[model samples]
Target: MYRFIMSLMLVLPVSVFSALNYLQEDITNDTTWTIQDSPVYIYGNITVKNGATLTIMSGVEVYFMLVEGDGGFREGSELYIADGKLIAEGTQLLPVIFTSGGDIRSDGDWGCIAVEDDSVVNLNHCVIEYAKAGLIFWNLSSMSEMASSVNYCRIYHSSEVGILFYNSSPTINFNSIKNNRYGIQTQGLSSPTVNYNDICSNYSYNFRNLSGLNQDATSNWWGTTNINEIEANIYDYYDNHNYGVVDYTPFLESSYFNEGGIGDKSLGWLRSIFVP
Candidate 1:
């Protein structure tokens, strides 16, 4: 009898372990996503309404579903914050993961984490990948006191831009931004404090400033320290006099690449062997 009961337990479906599957919904009140209910699936857009807070605990895996066709903006899943707050704090050993649900995943597989309208967001020790844009701050007024910060995160494999700012200033530091079309892009008077990051090997320009506003991006490792090589990888005022300049002077002497880190682990064991 004991052996039969043990055998039945082994044959149980994997869904038995899953806690909650959140479909398309609006978070109107304060909510906490805990680690116990891990591997949460977001089937549709998750909009955090005004004055609400969504707290994500450590080691939580948030998977966004893939939408078909070019109308990803209208159909794909995303985390949208408008006049709300998002606090996602994770530890080094067990960081949070935001990834796609499709089996054949690539860049732009899903939408992005978009923050707008005086929303406050803080992401630490997280891994965000396979999206149009990993993080985007848009339409924030100059007088707004609410600020966003992304630190110690791995944002990669984006089809469009890893981090984009549209008339918003966010503090971005100590992150690994790589393997995307554009590592970071700013427009419309957006001046972000971008420093201490490993921004490298993007398909196009590593950094681009289109608003004609000078950006202070110092002390970063651009895969190489050669001034000429780094300048060639960036599209700024140097490329066009009308555009803003990315001050990449005094670059880091050594590469701050951390192996076996957040996003590195998600790249799969076989792929990481050749693609790092």
Candidate 2:
């Protein structure tokens, strides 16, 4: 008599696996990071070389691993666009996320998204947190249309400045910049259009003018409508008249406290889920 044996097989879907991770690399051509690769890890500095474009899709999560080195000295996991372009456009419902990759998360976990000279950067509806600086514009070109634009973004929990500008004039509007050491810092003739943002609850200062150039920071909510409270939060020419004046007059009547979150709403739930 002959007997036959049967066996069972187990198969798993591709989506059940973890997302793809990347190391220090250069993007010399146009590339798109889709949402299917959720939680893409950046183990080291990723550079978009000259004449290249790096586009990130909505609902995508980019995690920056904490490497050993000083991020301020440009030795960490960062997205550097040098003479290149970065288009990170996310919808309100599915905004992109940039956060720390380690299990123990805190401020200054990674470097920043640095847009170097002659580079173009645009970020919309993105959540950037737990970094040295959320976004940085460094020595941008003088071209009128090459300004780095940041809108409807929630940039917070940065160990250093939230958004830093160095000789670059970008249009910054409708962003929730709070809970950082400094909300926005400008130097070397970097005069950005700072308006319609909720700048409050920062540790050191909300808006710092190191360029000594007059800045137009008006029509923003400073956590309170009280003039004394608002003025105390800003460190402009008034603090030391040698610096350029920061015209922060005509503050908004309504407080934008609730606007400090990811996407169109606050990410309090995500914070609770991750900060454990």
Candidate 3:
């Protein structure tokens, strides 16, 4: 698998001056809010609230300490993105950290770090690991129309899938998704533009799609070193490092390696942040 094989702690950057002031002033329950440490049995939904931006600092460990005491695994955490947004914009040098609390902690320990369907999710330069999946986008129609831009991130070592996209059209680029049951799982017409990623070494296939939209994975480092002809549709480019079935030789001659994926702004149906 394409696992990092080491546990790393990245230092995050401080919020910008204006953004910091805005966060301190607009955010509610800033002090009373609990920094999730132990497996706290959350029975209700947790919302960040409008005008309240929760800035998860980098290298700050968040442990989903859910326990399966006596009986089977108990019902754990469920973070409701009722409103507001989560800005986990970590840097390449200082990436944000989200992991289980204990040494032997399993994946999906807590509920998940969910971005409400109606809200905007901007995950830049973050390292999401050791959860059921790095991120989850659910109920696209209910949440805000803003699309998610997951860039320069590394997601690995999860129990289930890597990134799950339900009814959202997020742009995933410059990411390294490896060492998971499934790398990227797209279901129910969730059109995600995935490209320029090193998607390799997963237990199963790198990308899985069911909605049958224009989901593209191109110019990526697909766990192989062999250099040969390039193919796009219906070809396992990872194992062969080229066209496993289809013939992309004409495009390769012109140096056309990408699938020309459309960005979030061009989607014309969803709302999203800057196009990176």
Candidate 4:
């Protein structure tokens, strides 16, 4: 009977058991992560270099190993895209998820998806959480043609800044940024359009402008309608002269989130984004 069972195991289909796609090495060539290969695990730092493209289809859940350290990508896992293109587009129903491994979750569990250099980035309808920093755009080469955009996304639970733009100007809109140390921080000549977002309930300031350039941060819901309470959460020229002013007038009094958990611009119709 034992010998017959051993032979039967060899004949059975591989789908009888679990299937996992483990990634440890760097992605040098163009790669595509599909929904069939759901739950793609990354052990360490994965860099998408120049001329390469990494596409993650909808409903593809990505887990990064979280090794606590110096708040950098030393032992912790990270997805660094520099001089490459990353198109991670998820739908309103099933969005892409980037979270830490294991069941329990916390902030700074992993590093982040660092979009730098002359890379082409499109992070639409995605959910990113439990990171030291959700998205960091640093010194991107192009100002217009190569400008990166993030839309209809929810970024939260970051120990540091949710979105940090340094010397790079990226388009950020229609996102729910909450429960972070700093919701958004811009520095070093960064000129980003921060509009139509639910920038609420951050630990520190919601928007911090370190650069001298003025920022247009209008039409965002800062969790409250009280004018004094709203400006209290913003860090800019009023606090320090060197820093630029964050014009957050014409703010949304209350969130217009629909039943689908999306804040629609047109009465909150609900659109695409990541995570559950």
Clashes of 3: 9
Per-candidate TM-score against the hidden true structure: 0.83, 0.83, 0.62, 0.83
lDDT value for model 4: 0.78
> How does each model score on lDDT?
0.78, 0.77, 0.52, 0.78
lDDT of 1 by residue, 1-276 (tens): 223423543876545423344446778999888898676777667888869999998999888877555243434688988879999998899899998877767888888898885788999999999988998888746533137899999999988899988888889999999999999998886888888899889999899888778887777778876666777888887677787778775566556554322111222233223421
Residue-pair clashes per prediction, in order, are 0, 0, 9, 5
Stretches of candidate 1 exceeding 4 Å from the true structure: 1-19, 69-75, 143-146, 257-276
Against the hidden true structure, what lDDT does model 3 obtain? 0.52
Tens-digit lDDT string for candidate 4 (1-276): 223433544776644323446666678899999999887877668889857999999999998875555344333688988768889999988899998874578898888888776676888889999988899887744353236889888899988989998887788988899999999998887888888888989999999889888787877888887777877899887788787778776667677353122222421212112101
Report the lDDT tens digits of candidate 3 across residue range 140-232.
Answer: 572223466888888887667778777777788778788877787766656667767766677766666554444455456555432331122
59 Cα displacement, candidate 2 (Å): 0.3
Error of 1 at 100 (Å): 0.5
